[model samples]
Target chain A: MRGLEKLVTGRLEGVEHGSGVGMDALTQYRNSVKERLDSADVLVAKLVHENTVLSQTVETRTQEVENVRHQLKTLQNRVAELEGREARQEEEIEIVKDLFEHLCGVRVHKSYEDDTGLWFDASQGSRNGIMDYKLGFVKNESSAGTEVVYVPLLKQRSSDELRALQKQLPGYMFDTLSFPLKSLYQFYSKMARSLSKKIE
Target chain B: MRGLEKLVTGRLEGVEHGSGVGMDALTQYRNSVKERLDSADVLVAKLVHENTVLSQTVETRTQEVENVRHQLKTLQNRVAELEGREARQEEEIEIVKDLFEHLCGVRVHKSYEDDTGLWFDASQGSRNGIMDYKLGFVKNESSAGTEVVYVPLLKQRSSDELRALQKQLPGYMFDTLSFPLKSLYQFYSKMARSLSKKIE
Candidate 1:
């Protein structure tokens, strides 16, 4: 106990260096020493806990980084696949469009400006079966309950040629039933609007 | 100085808890006392740093949680909008299906079913003008030049009526042409396939 008393005296002496006049104030010196001792105990315990929590946080962050990298790789692969499919579909649509224009004389155009290639004109007419009239002539005949009939588009036909074709055809007659151009136009317009909306 | 001596003695008294014998073991106790004092100084500084770092980390995590919550809200809104559009499209498709059945005398079914409903079978002859006919039907037969024709589908015609209709008409002739059940099936199938693919 005497040795411990001597040791404490030595520690107090060491603290006296910067304290100087403050150390001479006995009450102040005593209070300062007590504060330092109590603070040191709390500091040690708090440091140990913080170290543990920091290590756990670092581990969790590393795991999160790895998960994000894996997701990025998966998303990149999907984008490549989708781009390839979009290219293929665009090609198929072009081929189908050409076939439709050639066989149907419908002049299926992506835009209104593409009208020079086909034989159809300002007035549109369509039929579903064999026809007797010459091309590019207009006539009115009651539908005979037959759903299929030939529709011939008489492009640039003179009034005389049209009258002859109409007179000769009789029961078969020239086409006056209007094609459902409005329905098709609406469908495509809606499709375009929807696509634009998606882009936005 | 007198008070300092008293303070030192008081501290040593607290350390003398295990000293039942005498000053023979006091040197070891003094060494332990020195180590504890030195460790306390360092532990104090370390605790301040740890506390500062922990506080900063907690603030950052709170902000991140708030940002994630905002993003989730945006995603939920987008999902709700898409669900609404999907419901409307479903109703429109049902109405269109009814119209097609009434107008074409063919029942529309999902593409997967076989030999049932108004499903178009491509293997059956190319009855519609839409199909690619390899040359069984007559092509541009006018003496003047090639002409574009739209053929209508003949409905429920007897053999005699069909023969008489053929004599009256002049463009391409067909033994039979199928209704456009397959086209409608293809359109819906493509749409469903595209949407499903997008979801995946």
Candidate 2:
């Protein structure tokens, strides 16, 4: 079929249209027609080839999309898990803190000095001088227990002032003997026990 | 050009080979050849259209892959951020808990009781009848403060046992007056002042 068109036709398409006598001219024309058919075949083959390549591309990209989607799903699950864990942890922290506060976390209104002591917290402003007494305590270790907490700051109070306070807050202890370590122990022991009452 | 093939060698590929004489046969052959060429043209057009569709599909799929990849990256970053936050929050919870422990979270080793009391914790196991003293206190509100906590059990001991304990732990107070309420206040006042120590 490739060169058949050139045979029948004299003037080349393969052998184009010729000015020959009757039969010869017809043959020449026929040959050229065959050539065109051959070319068309080739064109069709190329198009089919291109189609194959395009199909492959679509397949590959579709797979890639699926893989990425799977990855996204896994990440989403992880985020959900972490959010749950964080929320629970935060809540637990708050609960423990609450318990700690009740145990001995009570802070002095005006005398919030440190974790262990309260200086001049009870007495009114004796500012500029060491007039107020200090009250404080320490825990055995981690800090989830019962121990007296007290503090003070500036100036010494006269026996009169001490007696007055003792009279005012009868149940509240305001002893001044803690300066000497021995008295301090005695004061702590006393403080711890004073806050209790019969369950009945 | 299309009908040329059918002319000279007229056999009627489009019309069937005929035993006609000269010109008429050639004319008929040419016509059939033209028909074949037209069909070829139509086939090429169809192929081109199919190719275009394939190209469009490839482009769409490629874009989908890109979009999915972008989403995956964003999700990965979110996971990272959440992990960091959770880590920091967990660390903070631990620190606050440590501080609380040191403040007043101390538990009576043997006195291991509720959040607010240590009954026969200091006293030995009088675990049968009305014996050990009770000690407890409620927090002002949520529980993040300094308050005394105590508990107890049964079995009352004779006055002899009380006197013995008073001497053994000199600072530890042991009074049966709490039952009367008036003496209860006095006992508590006595108790709270005994646990403090001087900073010096």
Candidate 3:
């Protein structure tokens, strides 16, 4: 009976030890699973933060691009307007040159120099046919190798005709040759300004 | 004693009920935390996907802008080149016209409706030996305003000298003679072609 009692006690102790070991294993598994869940939560939170920052950065960049595009379009329009103005100016210059040619009995030569002026070649035609025409500089001096535009002016009476007129008119024939050249420039400027205004 | 034992049993049951309520509250809290974690994960994933798409779109838009800028620059350069070519062509045309005038002893007149080729008069000698060269175009087609352009083909000769030459060379002499007509046109065409080639 004694021996049987001793054996029973030893078996009970073994069972208790096995139960404790099983409980320890269960607690360790639970702790490992909880740690994995917490790590996953942290990773998702970091990703979310990073995504928010990237979205804001993209928004800022897009706005900058739009602003740049707007500026570029404005610049293009300005350049086009300037080119149109330049073309109009060139055409106006041609018309003015033509008008000068038609009005004066001298040839108008456009200088490529820093100054725009009129140059005359008085030594032309036959020896007996010496052309007498007055030429005045409009803007500047003449330069070598400059392209000169020659335009023959209107038909004016000869010196002999003028002398005949003077004899007939007598005292009324005073030399009104000396006129202020500045007035001519002012006249053309006024005409051009009026035309421009009309056209606008 | 039986009543006292019954009272103690009721108190123990109350303690067990309180423990059960606590366990239920813990379960509910754990479930709420799990739901929140799942929602956060979904939101993070969606944001990440959206950010990736936005980045790609921005890159594509930037490339398009660069391409447009390059094309605009190319177009501006082409326009400048065309303007330069036009200026050169105008210059070349003027040169050709001048050459023709020098060779033909004629001047081009841009009249309103009478754009026909005519003659220029070398008006010789006024009363004071002052003469002029006059240019006129055919206005009426009745030769009303037309004059004669005397070409200096030979050395200077007087009227008596020309009469003597006609008497000596009677076979070659003709009235209202117009020689070098075809050769003059051919020369003009050749010169024009050369000038055009230079511009090209």
Candidate 4:
């Protein structure tokens, strides 16, 4: 009886020991699962945050691109308008150059150094003397300040001829020749006619 | 001894039952963890794909914006060039218009209906009769085809005066007066001088 009691007690203790080991293993596994879940939560949170930032970045970039496109369109329109104006202005310039050459017998050359001017050198022979004229446009600061300058190369005759020419052509303001561009044809015609009469 | 054996057996059975319950809980927890991990993998893969596509979109958008900026810069340069040319052309036109008005002793009105033309009306009186002249530029497709048309208002003097004028101005090709824009001033000067002699 004593041996049988000892054997039964040993078996019971062994079973209890086995159960403790199994419970510990199960608890450890459960802890590992909980840890994995927590890590997944952290990863998901990090990924969501990163995605949100990326989305915001994309949105900003998209808006910037849109703005750039809009600006490009506006610039294109401006270029078109400028081109149209340029065409018309070019045609007008051609006509004006033609008239100057024919009426004054002067070849006008564009002044590269001057932004808003042209230059012509011509000799007008008269009974008294031959006068050399340097004609051009000079821009001033004011809106109507642009002047047509006629500088006689012959300094001696300049004063007398200029005075006479100014008197003969009463319509023109002689000292600086501050006349409108539209009336330039009339000024040149009078100059040509008066100069021709003197020469004849 | 019998009582001790029974007690040991009961303890062993209870331990076994508790271990089974613990193992079952562990399996359930592991399964839950596995499910969560699988879902997380799928979510991560989806997010990664979305991010990749979004990154590509952003890259493409960035490149497009850069292209637009380049275009805008190019267009701005074009506009500046056009503006410069326009300014020069405007100055030239102003000079030509002035010369035409002075030499012809007539006012030139811009013909809006004609894109490339101007018109003038004048009456010249002679001992024989009075003749009305309509002078203008007529654009032609070919270089030599463009002509300065002089239409007589009075049909009676048209035949005789046209012949006499043609004979008087031998330099001019009388039929069409097809002259270059540059030569227009010379042609008009000749016409005016001849007409003035005839009138005198």
Candidate 5:
């Protein structure tokens, strides 16, 4: 009976030892699982944070691009307005040029010296008196106002004759006049008429 | 002895059942972890795909914006070019107009009737012989060539006198001459000299 009791006690102790080892294995497994879960949670959180930053960056960049587009639209409108004004100005210039050409019956030429004036040819009722005419504005040192200079070809006429003629024509102030075209024409017409009457 | 055997056997069976239950619980936990890992993998793949597509969309939109910027630059250049041309043309027109006014001795006015011409007053040496001159281009139905019309005030002159005058002035073609100003001036000058000689 003593030998049988010893064997049974030894078997019970062995079972108890086996239960202790099983509990330790379960504890180790639970620790490993907890660690894996913690790591996964950290990864998900990092990914979510990165995604939020990227989305915000996209929104900011989109707003900046929209602002650039608006600026481009405004510039386009300004360009169109300038082009329209330029076209109208060009048309106005053409009309004025055509009118001048038709009325004067002459080809207009820019002066060789500068772009400030124009030069042309005129005749006094006959080829015997062809004149090269220059029409321009001049500023005198003593004068406050600009004067219109109308120089007709006076190769045959003396300075005395020119002075007398200027005196006879009320508007001429020594080849310069306030009124340009009208005064020049009147001076020539009066001279012609006076010369004609002298012969008559 | 029988009672002791029953106690040991029952305890052994209880331990086996507890181990079986622990194993079942561990398996259930493992399966749940595996399901979570699979769902996370699917979510990661979806996010990666969306990121790639978004990146490609950003590239395309950037290219579109760049294209618009290039177009805007080109338009701006064109506008500047047009404005420059318009300014130069305006200056040219102004010079031409000033030249005509100075040479012609008349006020240039646009005819209200048509865009074909301008009107001005002219004189034949005396106020008694003032003339309304029409200087214009004419295209006759019967003629293939365009003619320049220079109609002078012929109020007192007879048709017979005009025909004789036209014959005497080699350059006159019934007041329609290829060279308007020179021919008209020559004809008038010859008449004035002839009339002066007659009076003398």
Candidate 6:
């Protein structure tokens, strides 16, 4: 609209300036106008070409942005899913390690740098018939037939109480013992049969 | 350039067709040419305006696309990092659980659906001097002062071998007992007192 307004202004100026011109001057004015129009036409064609190319590029870029946005949404969901899985897995490791240490009285040393045997040094804690056992766990490889397990059962007691009992009772002795899981099953079954009826 | 070429073509045609023209005919031709020039000038002005606006829009759109691409790169890296963390956490859980089950001879059941206590039932395996204790772990809440832990030590042996030994040796016996972690430390230290006086 502004360009059109400028055109109107130019026409009004032409009315004021172009009055009483000779025929030769009119011929000259006509030539000048035609040359100006020629150059303007050329400029217009170039502008049209540039605009066409720019419009196409913008359209393509906009589409790419939309596609990337969609991809971003999918990736966001996947990242959340993986994060949830990781937190849960970390919690499980912490729980199992805590329970193992609480029950066995030995710190488990697991090095992620290497994946081989799982071990805890019970050489320090083995003491009595009930709390004097050493334990170790071997990995079960695919080549192995069955998952090997060694279960040891011992009771929890206070060190101070045991010391007090020992001072009162002379000539008492306790020792560490080893037995397979199956031995425990048989031993307990036999003992259960001999349980005192009064205690039951 | 092609628009300029068309102008040249029109001028050559004018030279060929406008020969021997009178003043009246020339004036009529000039006016007609002036009208065409006015319309062409208007079109040129409109095109220049459109091209300026289009160029500005394209520049802004290009900058937006660049910014979006940078954000996409950052998000992609975050997704990859989370995935790596998840994989490592998963591997640690597998390693810990496998080892715990192998050493304890019991499957560990961990439920991540809730966050509270950690538990394992050893009622089935508690028997004998070597493996007759129960083990359970409680979470260490910040509200509590100390992480309370109970430890028991038991040995491993084959049940069939024990049965055979019992049959061969009359009045042989095996039994389970309980003791505290501190008691174990004292007892083991004392036993280290009795380790073969000759073996050294």
Which of the numbered candidates is closest to the native, going by highest lDDT? 4
lDDT preference between candidates 3 and 6, better one? 6
Question: Candidate 5: what lDDT?
Answer: 0.48
Candidate 3 chain B: worst 10 consecutive residues by lDDT?
B123-132
Model 1 lDDT per residue over A21-80, tens place: 232443443444455455454556667677677756755654554555455455555555
Worst 10-residue lDDT window, candidate 1 chain B: B123-132
Candidate 4 chain B weakest ten by summed lDDT? B1-10
Model 2 lDDT vs. the true structure?
A: 0.48
Off by over 4 Å in 1: A1-38, A102-107, A111-200, B1-38, B46-200
lDDT of each: 0.38, 0.48, 0.39, 0.56, 0.48, 0.47
What's the DockQ of model 2?
0.28
True contacts kept of 3: 0.08
The candidate scoring highest on TM-score is 4
lDDT of 3 by residue, A1-200 (tens): 23322333343344335534243432342333244345545655677677677677667667766766676676577567656755754554453333223222122344222245433332111112222233333432333332323232324657784454334332312322222333332222222222222110
Off by over 4 Å in 2: A1-24, A106-200, B1-21, B106-200
DockQ of each: 0.09, 0.28, 0.05, 0.27, 0.13, 0.20
Report the lDDT of model 3 for residue B96. Answer: 29
- Stretches off by above 4 angstroms in model 5 are A1-95, A111-136, A147-200, B1-28, B59-67, B70-74, B77-95, B105-200
iRMS, candidate 5, in Å: value is 14.7
- Ranked by lDDT, top first: 4, 5, 2, 6, 3, 1
**Ten residues in sequence with the least summed lDDT for candidate 2 chain B:** B122-131
lDDT of 5 at A154: 62
After superposing candidate 3 on the true structure, give the runs of residues whose Cα lies further than 4 Å from its correct spot: A1-25, A105-200, B1-41, B64-200
Q: What is the Å distance of residue A5 in model 6 from its true position?
A: 17
Model 5: reference contacts kept, as a fraction = 0.22
How many angstroms is residue B28 displaced in model 5 relative to the true structure, after the best TM-score fit?
A: 4.5
Tens-digit lDDT track of model 4 for B1-200 = 22322433344345446635454543443344444456666766677777788788888888888898898889889888887877767665655454334434443344232566665454543333334556666676776555666655545565766766555544433343445655654555665555545522
lDDT tens readout by residue for model 5, A1-200: 23322433343344335645364444444444344445445655566666666666666667767876787888778777877877766665555544444433333333433454333343332212223345555453456444456566566667775554454433432353344344554444454443333210
Candidate 4 clashing pairs, residues 3+ apart or interchain: A96-B96, A184-B98, A185-B98, A185-B99, A185-B102, A186-B102
Model 6, A1-200: lDDT tens digits are: 33543553464345336644344544454455445555666667777888798788778878877887777788778778877877777767767665555443334544333244433333112222222223433444653533223333324447763453344322212333334433432332222222211221
Rank by DockQ (best first): 2, 4, 6, 5, 1, 3
Q: Each predicted model: what fraction of the native A–B Cα contacts (within 8 Å) does it retain? A: 0.09, 0.54, 0.08, 0.54, 0.22, 0.42
What value does the TM-score of chain B take for model 3? Answer: 0.43
